[model samples]
Target: MQTESNGKRKRPKKKGSRFMRNAKGFAKQGIFGRGTHIDDDQFSYFINILDAMKAGFEDVEDRVNMANNVFEQTVDKEIHLSSNQIVSKAIESLIGFVDDAQLERFFGKFGDNLRPMCSDRFASHVLQKMLEIAFLRGLGQAAAQEQSEADAPGPAKRAKPDAAQVEEQYNLETDFSDKHREQCRNFVLRISKFMLNNLEDFVWDSCATHIMRSAILCLVGIHVPKIAFEKGGAELAKHRKLYTVPEEWHEVMKEFPQRLELWPQFVDFPYQEHSSALLGVICLSLSVVDKSMLKHFGKKILTQSLLKPNEDNGDDDDEKKESKIEIDDDNDDQGNNEKQDDNEKTEKPNSEPAVLLPKVFHYQCAVILLETLLSVAGAKLLTQLYAMLFSGRVAHLSQQQQTNFAVQRLLQHIKEVSDFESVFTELQPQTEQLLKMGYTGVVSALSGACLRLGAKQAQMIAALQSALHVTGDKEKSKLFFNCLVKLKPHELLAGDQSGFVHLHGSLIAQHILQFNKPIFLVNCILELPAEQLSQIFNTPNGSHIVDAFLQSKYIGEKSRERLIRQLDGFYVDLAITRHGSRVLDQCFKAAQEAQKLHIAKELSNKANMLKGSPFGRLIYTKYRLDTYKLSASQWQASLGQQQQKEESVGQTNKRPAKTATELFKDILTQ
Candidate 1:
């Protein structure tokens, strides 16, 4: 009877049985359920909640909090699932529902709650989702508005959009409405402020510091989208809408300069730890700020302040004294076994010394900021930076290494943006001064810039002539050599100019050959007129260049033929000289089969004259060995045939065939 009653009764349904069942299923599979099949009803329910959230339904906050709790539980139960998976799905569902009004209201009430979540890895994702949703909604509204305006009427019926209107529309389409823009700006600013306000709490915490840095970078990319514009210009504009700075964004731009002013305070921090993050923010800021503002604020505050020598050397001295006291305390511990009374031994304080900005740190930051300014602000800031570099003000700084590095970086930036000829003209008078100061990098960079700019042959030749005067130092000469090699100044060197008259073409050619082996250099050497080639081939140092040319694998077939022709009458003369004989040997080795045979025949004619000289004797012996080796092989083949004939006749072959040694002696005697 009990079994029959149990069978008759139906099981009672649990509270939210359907939701629980679906949630369990979703936890097992993905958001769309198993495979490609989607549970539309369940998806619609999820989207409905997003709609409610966007509409600010009376119980929306409570519902969202409850949903979040359920999501966390599901994630906990299903160890395979990630928090990001749930957050991504939630964000996707809310994308269509989220609008500017919703974001403003959400932030207004919950902004304070958002700051603490930035430090939480999972919670930061949700905050980022909120920002992304707000950005997408703003974009949708802008695109819709643009389409409406575009479809409005013809120019006859309505005035076409002016440049200002077009620019404004572009800003809206790209960045969003001014109100939404402000909210996004404030969102990032608030996070930055939170980190700054709670500096001690976040400074040593890696996670918090990373969040802060990421937030800053995000703000930089968003607020300074125009930075890309400065680089790509109209070429970038053709494919996508360009960003224009709006009047409303002026408030956002103001935050950067204020932050830049705080740079000095951070100088005492571990530069290796914080410099990249700080420089990234500053560079991005410089790229977006107005040129006038950049010139005024960046030049006056950042550059000028950094360029000046540190006035607080006295503070560094005090810190050294404090360090000495700490060392003495450490020594006291090792010297005595008995513990001293606190009164007897003065206890030094354990506090860190106050960090004054180092001169090197300021110089590094100044150089980086100046480079950023030059890239974005164009010629105006470039002129200012150049003036500052040459003004001798930096010489007064404590560290020359920092100043030199700054100059090198500045010159590199200038090379990229300005005409090299103009830069050279401006810097030419100071070239000697720069060299005297041991700034060879500047000279090298300047030479490269000039060459890249396609500076005229005469001018480059003159520069090379002037630069060669500082050949006393091996390192300086190497720097000049590298510059000349990269410049491929062979064309200028080949030309008949008075400037190169003072310069030894062969010496320069030898230097170029040693450091660079480009095909063009080989071609240049081969293409030299007979007079010049002969001149270079005659000199002891110059013959090495000829040897380099012959030995290079890049020497073309036609160039080889031309080179062989040039050596037509000079082989005997070259074979007698100490350096020239090496070149003659290389010529024989590198020449094609036909050229090699011709050269061997020509040298064999002068074997007597060549054999008299020490270097030439080696060439003479090589020639004789090569010619006789094939003959000796043929003689052995013939001698074996004769011996076979004798064996067939059943007779012992008593006549011995000539050995290779005997054959070589016979050829030499003949």
Candidate 2:
């Protein structure tokens, strides 16, 4: 489902700029924006911005001079430079990537330049980028670096600096801190004034609306990474840069001039009917990802890695590279052909016919933007989002091109039974159709949401079973499990045919295993012959299914023991590999006393192989195979105390906290 698509699925294409004939226009050429009497200095800023984004301040001086000089030639006296050209140039260069020196200059010029650009269609984008870059650079210059420096220990004061004495020390302070920071603050204040000054112009004017949203991001220091919508789903969605700014920046926005505050503008935006799409995306982004997590993880990782750019379920390989988007038209056409061929071969005669999705111009930006929002959304914020978006439209949205992605992401965040049912009710009937129609990502995300919320496990399985054409218990064959595991269909079971770990399908398997009543799936999985299981045990993600089984509270201890018993003969083989060794280690930890002995005895005989592997040696030492070799009885006895301690610790964690009154009464009695 994630790796292949069968439906006539439509993906948003990058809208190319209007191409001009080479011989027709007798003028110097540039990327994106073009105009009469072009100002080389202004346009070169974009070239500089592009360099900053790609290479990050490398050869800054050379870029600055070269960029400043690019459009320097004098133009016709009567003609004026088009501001739209400026926007075309600016939008191509992401605002988040600009250098600080360039930022200081932009902030200084923004207020004077913003007025003309704010209302113009192409120019508004430039306005938004300037606001983002100025605040981003400003926050880094002041809040992140300066604050760290302020409290940092001096050479002499490192040993001692009492609070009272340090406060008493002479300190003369100029308002704010550095010139760069002042420019940032002024830029924010001026923008605030501009917005407050032109309330109706901003509210009614379509182009100016997003600038308000950008300012809100600046005020809050929330950067939703630029949403690049292309071909493919989460499997191909690689690590995208996540939004980050200093925590101290929030305080700075708070102290802005009261008359120029953005609150009124924010409050007024939602009343406009059209604001729903834009406002919904931005608001959810802020609400879903908590302020605290952004502060903690935001600094350490890129937003995509932080929010997780892939699927919402946090598949094992969350840190992997960009999803391979089918960019070339010919290559994309070829890929579609292959997927269709695969789908046709796999389609079951009894399987419900999938509804064909109409190919349409995808609202690619909106989809990407919403997906980005869902990525950052925190667990605590799920309740709010569930109430806001999921209201009897889950299926309707899933059927459409743009909203399907939003639904896919939203489903991943579902936490309550009510929320799941609300979504499941609308989506249940079409679940099979959606799966057949190449929307397996939607199904995979739904499974993940089910597992996360602990809702509708039986119903979810039923929907999938029917979809997989294994509605009857007897019909559930290795092929059914295989189809579900690969998220692709097969006319017959062929060993090792499933390629590159069908990511979405594997996610479905992992999610199903974690469910409270995952016996059916577990049984189906256990049937995957030892050879197949061996392959699964060693895979980067497939092994996660094993982890899900071992780690799930719902899966019975007996089922876990059965798994260990099943792996009995292969214990040594498993212990000598990376992922397999981890699985073995987990199995031993979760294993019953006898099961542990079984694993240890097997590993004890293969000491040479175990010691040879880096992972294997750790397993050998951790399991105390040498002690087992000395005496099985002694090894078994040595583990008794450890097992007892582990059980006690587990019980302690599971135990409820004492009430204050009860604790007080117990203390008095003692």
TM-score, per-candidate, Cα-based: 0.35, 0.54
lDDT of 1 by residue, 1-670 (tens): 0011211113333333354356457756656433223355545554454345445434334544544443443322221221233333443233223345544554553365644555554344445444433333333333321222333345543456532233234334453467776676566556555655665566545446555444443443332121100222233232222122234434444454555456654443323344434444444444443445555654554454444545556666767644544453576663252234322433644543222333434545455444444444445555665565443333222124444445444445553344444556655655544434444455555544443343532454445645545245543433343233322222233343321211223433443333323443455556556555555465565566666565545555677678877777678777877767767767766666566656666676777888789878877775563443456455335545655775777545232565433332222111
Model 2 TM? 0.54
Give stretches of model 2 more than 4 Å off: 1-102, 119-127, 137-179, 202-208, 225-277, 285-426, 471-480, 488-496, 537-541, 561-670
Clashing pairs in 2: 40-71, 236-323, 238-322, 238-323, 242-303, 242-304, 288-377, 288-378, 289-377, 289-378
Off by over 4 Å in 1: 1-113, 120-250, 259-276, 279-283, 308-358, 361-370, 377-405, 413-444, 448-670
Per lDDT, the best of the predicted structures is 2
Cα error, candidate 2, residue 99 (Å): 8.0
